[model samples]
Target: MSKHLFSASLLLAISLVVGKSAWGDDNAQSPEPMPPQLEATIKAFEAIGGMHEYRECYGFPSLKFHFFGLKLDSTDADIKKMPVVPFPFAFTSISNSITDLGVAELAKQKNMRALNLVDAQISGQGLAELTHVKDLEVLNLSNSSIQDKGLEALSNFPQLRALRLGNTEVTDDCFVYVSRLKDLEALDLRFTQVQGKKLNELKPCEKLQQLLFSGCPVTDERLQELGKREALEGLDLDYTQVTDNGTKTLENFPNLRNLSLSATKIADQGLEDVGKQKRLQRLYLSGTRVTDEGMSHLGGLDQLEELALSETKVQDAGLAKLSDLKNLNNLKLIRTQVTGTGFDAFSDVPLQTLNLSHAPISDSGMKAIAQIKTLKELTLDHVPLSDEGAKQLASLDNLTLLSLGHSNIGEEGLKSVSQMSKLRVLDLSDTPVSDDSIKELAKLKELRLLYLSGSVITKDSIAQLKKALPNCDIQSDSK
Candidate 1:
């Protein structure tokens, strides 16, 4: 049973035994029983591995249920029992099991604020059932069987703010219905057949701030049509046919804050145009041709907070250019050419999260990284960290999570790791650590989780270490 259900049952048991209400008022009368419809709805939802909990919705506490990737095998009798609830529910990836009948059951939720049917088996006709949900603000039908015919139901939702139709059968013909949603603020058409021309129909959506066409065949000609949307705050064109020429359209969106062009043909010249978006806070350039030259263009984005340059040609020299990004906190440089030589440039940047996995960072790089005292979580998986290099990490006193899996750290390094008294989670998996390191590992009394998997540590040593740190969840494999 779920924790919520168990607590409810326990509360009922206490109420009966003490002759008091569940709210702990002895003199107060018992609360009214749940209505039959509500009870049946709860049972129908729970039968499909759905879980509900009270969460703050708007200002007041409201019940919310979530069903993800679960096969909805509830019988027709159970479906009939699924009545309307004055709450929201998410049915994501409940593939092919939920048909028009299931959607009709969900349609009874007239007050639902958000509905997610991503990758569901519902058809366009099935979506018509949700037309009665007048207050619905968010609707996601991405990767479903929904087509243009089903989108006609969208016109009924005047309060709709965010709509995701990515990877669906909907073509440009669907935008005619989508354009009717004047309140729509976000629209996602990723991996869909809709080209850029039909997006012009969304001119009615003046509140539209976010538009995504990632993995679509959006070309420069079609993308240029969207240049008029100066109010756009976020736009994604990852894996599109857009090139450097298409990047020129970015200059039109002065308010763009979050932009992604990952896996596109955009290069340094395109980045030069991207650099002009001074207000950009989060930028993704992974799996592109971005090099050190392109990195120079991002130096002016002082408001940048998160940057993804993984699987790119970025090197240590490029790090110096990003030092000006004072707000940069989360940076992913996985599979990059960075050796950590220019890490000192961020020593004063207040960076808290850094991932350098699979990078050939040397001992000098580790020393440079140690200078950045603000890091709280660091990932160096599959990196070449020598004993001395690993010892340098002890300087990061604030580090709570550290992943050094598949690294070259040894017994000497394990001794230095024990010095991180504030570390709550540590990953030394697939390393050369052995039973001899148990003495040092036991010193981490504050550790909540420790991973020693794929190490040569014996089962007996792990037991001994566990005895010293009873609260720590130690995971290891016996030699």
Candidate 2:
């Protein structure tokens, strides 16, 4: 019987025993009677492990006990002889040096569910032992020194759903063996030598939803094949040779929503196909050759919500097209060229994040952004925004994170931003703010992280500021 029902039976037995008076007088009241079935159930529990820990609940239709991490090797043969918590599910760790092959063997024998041999130093030989467990669902072999040989052994597991092979020496050929497991859903091939020839064999599993090919040789062409998978929802192809042609192939994937094409040759023409995919919600084209021309195509995508163009050739003109995408919520133009005209494009859209670092924006650009009352996060690092721009930004009551690092803002400009009570993370680095304005910052009790690097403020000033705001994490490179 379940442990919970067994515990309830034991409690009923104790109440029955306490109610009966062994030597009661003839006139004395009879003790409360107990159920005989409950007493018998207690005897059954005592026959087993003698109840180390047990609980019963009628509110929810489930029973659980804490026999995990308990030593099954006891001196008493009565308890020592029983099966070691058959199908150990919540068991935490098993040392390899102990040679407890019975642990994995028992799981297979009893139809156990989850097995985590992560960082256990298991190799091909150890993995071979697990293939017999056909019911295995989730297996984590991360940092276990599993090579391609070990991965080859996993092909036998027919029910494997999630597998982690991070930080292992497995190569691209490993995907060939991994692909054989048709039931596989989630896989991690991060930081492997899988590229070119190795990547050609990596195809979509029937149920695979999330796949991480970070630091691998997966180009845009491979991602194009992946995009066609009806089940694929998330794909990461960061730092690959895939170009706009590869992305065009992805238009075949009607279900694709999130795609990362960072550090590639994706330009405006590449985005033309991407813009046509109405299902695309988020696209990352950072560190590429995408310019304002690419923005023209992106403007046509109705479902486009988030776009990241960091470290690209995207200027203000490209961003103007985004005004047509009513669902566009976040836009990152960091280290790009977004001027006043581009900032005005967001006036109609409700954006939450706007990163324009290393741009050449003036006060006019800030005024244009001020029209976006939905803006919560704004970055103007290394830009030419002056005190007037700062004043315009201070007017946005929804502003939470503001970075004015290396900008031409003075003490007066910094003071203008002090009224933003909702500000959480502020970077005033390389500005002309002095110790006199530190007191004003203390009023922003919601501030969590504050950066004052390369500013005119002194070390003593930071120390005094810390004293006023003891709980805030202040980072200053002034020394």
Q: Which numbered prediction scores highest in lDDT against the true structure?
A: 1
Model 2, 1-479: lDDT tens per residue?
11112232233232121111111111222222333443443454346544421211101001111111222222223332334344323222333331224334433433434454545555666567655567765565656667886677776577776676766788866877888878776676666666645543556477775566656776655564453466765555677677777776765566766777778777778887877777777788889898877788887778877788889987777777778988887887777767756768676787887878787887888899888899888877778877787788777878777887777887677777888888877888767778887878887777766878777788988898888778667878766
lDDT of 1: 0.75
What TM-score quantifies how close candidate 1 is to the native fold? 0.85
| Residue 370 miss distance in model 2 (angstroms) | 1.8
Q: Which candidate has the highest TM-score of all? A: 1
- Per-candidate Cα lDDT values, in order, are 0.75, 0.63
lDDT of 2 at 470: 80
Off by over 4 Å in 1: 1-49, 56-77, 87-95
Specify the poorest-scoring 10-residue window by lDDT in model 1.
Answer: 56-65
Clashing pairs in 1: none
lDDT of each residue in 108-213, candidate 1, tens digit only:
7676666666666777677777778887776778777888888887877898877888889888888889989998777878899877777678778887877888
